[model samples]
Target: MKNAKPDLVYFSGFYSEATPFIKQLRAEMKDVKFLAGDGVKNDEFIKGAGADAEGAYLSLPSPVYTGEAYKTFGDLFEKETGIKRDASPFVAEAYDAATVIIRALEKVAQEKDGKLVIDLKKLNEEIRKTELDGASGKIKFDARGENVGGETPVSLFQVKNGAFEQLKQ
Candidate 1:
């Protein structure tokens, strides 16, 4: 790599393998830029990579919430769970997913012999048609069941001083 030094080195794997590989790369090539996906955007990765994790770029394929709706959800989440909402980057997204499921269930659930019965096919269809402004931002599924209503598909983050900070778009 010294002979053909690239400007950047991108790793597409989990922290378990990426930590060691990136540490080695950082040790050998301090001048090159390092980038990875959400899999390595956690405290574990930073701890594993040590100082080598600094200045590394990470991408999260989910929305970053900062609006009032999110703030309200965060407050309630902290109160109910006794854990800060920001503790996990995916909490808002998970909450939005659960909200979507519950809404779908409400739409498709039926009463049969005093018992709730939900048709799996109808529930799936209702879920696919979901459109809601959730804690993580807009939630809408495309034809392929991929959320396409988010402000952006991927939020860029940089590891600075052993902490992941989301970069503004």
Candidate 2:
């Protein structure tokens, strides 16, 4: 393989599996670029691959709560859990999902003659019609119950100087 000149290579596997391959291949082929999936986007991959990870690229759905505008939620989470920002990509998405569900429940809840009643059918419909600004950007569902509108951002990052840096458009 050293005689062959390839510009790029793609690795698809969990970090544990892919990191060793990346380290080995990078040692042999210094000029080639490596692209990986979301599995290798964590700290373990960087630590395992060491210097080989530099210049590696990976792309994944952008976690919407990392920006300056979302500092309040980030601060609160860190304060409560003692976890730093960007520790998990799903935190903001989970929060947004819960918010959507709560909003739907509120809209579908009704006050009877005296007590509160919740209709499951109406709650489902309300959930389908949910549209709001959430922690993970705008939350709007299509007929298929999939997010269809607003900024669904994908981020492309490169490992540089032992850290992942988001590339500008």
Candidate 3:
């Protein structure tokens, strides 16, 4: 099978499972292109696979740790945690989630008879009506409580020189 090599090999699993396959494939067929799922699109995968991780491709929602919009959050997070970590898609999603929840609560919470009362039903309605420009991008929900546009923009990246390089298409 090594002699009859394919042009592309794809791995659709977590970094733990994909890294070993990448390493084995690197030893067997160094030139074949490796495509992976979002699970292997992190620093841990690169660290685990070493040089064999280079030139590998993966697709992820949103740009990782890029764009001027995320500079403040990234800087503050690094300063507070003292841990420099790659900004993954989850970070943006989390920010948007928190924003939506807080915004909805603010709209539904009321001071009634010297007591703070929150209407749960109203909060849900507010959440469905949420529209805000977030670090990830514009966030708006449909009646089904899903992002109006369905999925976020997916960007393709290639591992180059031990770092993720976004491929502009």
Best by TM-score: 1
State the TM-score for model 3.
Answer: 0.73
Q: Give the Cα error of residue 143 in candidate 3, in Å.
A: 1.6
Candidate 2, residues 39-128: lDDT per residue as tens digits? 777877888889989999987787455454357666887899887656645566777788888988888898999999999888888998
Compare candidates 1 and 3 on TM-score and give the better one: 1
How big is the RMSD of model 3? 4.4
Query: What is the clash count for each candidate, in the order shown?
Result: 0, 0, 0
lDDT of each: 0.84, 0.79, 0.79
TM-score of 1: 0.75
Angstrom error at residue 19, model 2: 2.3
lDDT of 1 by residue, 63-165 (tens): 6677777899999999998886865458888888999999999989999999999899999899889998889998889877898876666878888888888
Clashes of 1: 0
lDDT of 2: 0.79
